[model samples]
Target: MEKFPGAEEWVPARGGLPKVAERLKDCRGCDLWEDAEQVVPGDGPAKARMMLVGEQPGDVEDKEGQVFVGPAGRLLDKALEAAGITRDSVYITNAVKHFRFERRGKRRIHKTPAVGHIVACGPWLAREREIVKPELVVVLGAVAARALLGTGFKVTEHRGEPVELPDGTAAVATVHPSSVVRSEEYRRDFGLFVDDLRAAGALLA
Candidate 1:
């Protein structure tokens, strides 16, 4: 395991997300960073009212050093626009900063980050929430939900409902855009995901 920087001692002195991102460049708090090209920080308006958190980076994201630029991201952009939510109006990020993957021939297949890894990277998420202070937090899948709430979070049962956080922020759970894209039943589920995005948008409005 890679030795990460001490999370307790590495508080950011500068304000805003960019400065926080600068701090993350040297993050050795978890082993994921060692293999990851670099930490992918959340992007968008620092003063956005809504923040959307997904699971983690994908192959394209890891290569491009930007969040949500792949097929899933394109879908997310379309859904957000359809729901009357501008992409620039919300902050977007992943629960885990690094892209965890397994090599399969020439392809790098995505691997879910373990709970321990999530916990190890929790401090960065916390820092993001603090800086954004968004009115509504949209968690796009169970993994993101679990990282924000707890392990037992059930996305199927809880999706579209707003849950209040201890920090006075409201959170909404929904299917990840990538899941919607991968489903053979995308026609049926895509509408539902769009509805969920609309609901999240309403909360922000």
Candidate 2:
């Protein structure tokens, strides 16, 4: 199976945020657990007001077993700062918890999680939402949008706009920080990215 059948099997009986993470540490939800150093579970408060979801871990994140500690994460921090959002104000996690990669020579290049992987990893996200119950869920990049919104959702068409989730919580779609890093127009794209964060922040008031 590309994705795990569900995250429930990995969930602890207590089902607290910490237990969720502890259980996830041993998750074999999908084959991703086979290669990664560890499962990169969500990081932040148990009841954070906002939750940020990215696609998957990058090179640095995979090694560190943290969701956002690398370049893209640093960039995301800047965008959040520019938008008046503090690091403590949001819970951050990846839509897929593992790093899927392909090795070339000495480098392990990041590979996008396939649709089946996304579907497989759906349970952890649901578990995170159940635990945090955030007022807003920010979807960064197409992969997250696909997992939370639907496969048909596109960040380009929906960026900076708030949409209602099936659970009724407000969710917003935006580009991943990696996209801005890759953009030729870093300044321009970063500005737009910050704008999207601001929109998400505005709803907090």
> Against the hidden true structure, what lDDT does model 1 obtain?
0.84
Pairs that collide in candidate 1 are 4-28, 4-29, 5-28, 5-29
Q: Candidates' TM-scores? A: 0.93, 0.96
Off by over 4 Å in 1: 1-6, 11-13
For all candidates, the clash counts are: 4, 1
TM-score, predicted candidate 1 vs. hidden true structure: 0.93
Q: Which 10 consecutive positions of candidate 2 have the poorest summed lDDT?
A: 1-10
lDDT of each: 0.84, 0.88
Q: Could you say which candidate leads in lDDT?
A: 2
Clashing residue pairs in candidate 2, if any?
Answer: 3-120
Cα displacement (Å) at residue 82, model 2: 0.6
Predicted candidate 1 versus true structure: per-residue lDDT over 113-176, tens digit per residue: 8777777777888888888888899989978987887877889998899887667689899989
Q: Worst ten-residue run, lDDT, model 1? A: 1-10
